[model samples]
Target: MSRGFVKESDQEELPIIPPRAPLPAGVINYVTPTGLAALTAELNALEAEKADFPTDHEGEHRRAVAVIDGKLALLRPRISSARVVDPAAQPQEEVRFGARVTLRFGSSGREQTFQIVGVDEANVKEKKIAFTAPIAKAISGLWAGETADFRMGGKAEKLEVVKIRY
Candidate 1:
């Protein structure tokens, strides 16, 4: 309890926990059946990781646990608030949440396909986009062969719904 008694080396830096995807305020947290499973799996993995942490290195172990706990704190709310929607139950005629849609862009006339998924489940590599995304929103109520104007990079591009599948 004396001045300059504490050493700088004794201080530990707090781990920086990354935030999950942005779910806008007032928007419901919707997830596909598979998406909920994925979240559950993630929670299990984190729990396992925490339980298996080596104890010999006390400081490192503590930090790791803190990081895991921080991550869990962020994840639990998402899991609890999740409203699972069955893709198979959605209407096959129009684009909606959990629907795999194929779109044909104007001018280039090129085709691309993506699934409208939950915010937490959105992965570009998997061709999954969030329901709140602009393109997804634009095509939400559209049926096959219907066109919608989407603003991409401040320019409007026409998107035609070529196909929709749950």
Candidate 2:
């Protein structure tokens, strides 16, 4: 005797909802609004263009679309990403996630500053670097005044952690 329903013999169907998978540990996940828009655009583009490519010759296109999807799938995580690290933290001499590092470019006569961020907030032009980046990996857990070397344009460059801010 279902309330306000049909006969008792009529079976009611329950709503179907899929369970989501848990995020992996230590994998930081965060994305700025800009990043979210960019990923959404990529998704739209992929969906729109995927049908245009011939099924027999869409290997490269398919892979590219898959990559975009993979990136979008990281909007959440089990372990918070370094990009979302607390910005209000006090400045420290040690290099770590969310630290803004100033490095002296070896090849060029200039100094470059980068905010060590998670992959979601990484915008090289904006001087935001992902913690998982080569330079970040090399500098992470190192104290200020420590120098790390990396190759750029096939030439070696030395970078010094001059300053860090929350």
Best by the lDDT measure = 1
All candidates' lDDT scores? Answer: 0.94, 0.61
Write down the TM-score of every candidate. 0.95, 0.51
Worst 10 residues of 1 by lDDT: 2-11
How do the residues 1-166 of candidate 2 rate in per-residue lDDT, one tens digit apiece? Answer: 5576775334433323333233236655544444445545655665566556556645555555555455445433322332334544534767777777887765674777888765655777888977667888887777667778888778888877666665
Q: On a 0 to 1 TM-score scale, where does candidate 1 land against the true structure?
A: 0.95
Error of 1 at 7 (Å): 4.9
Highest-TM-score candidate = 1
In candidate 2 the C-alpha lDDT for residue 23 amounts to 26
Q: Which tens-of-lDDT digit does each residue in 55-133 have in candidate 1?
A: 9987889889999999999999999999999999998898999999999999689999999999999999999999999
Model 1 residue 121 CA deviation in Å: 0.7
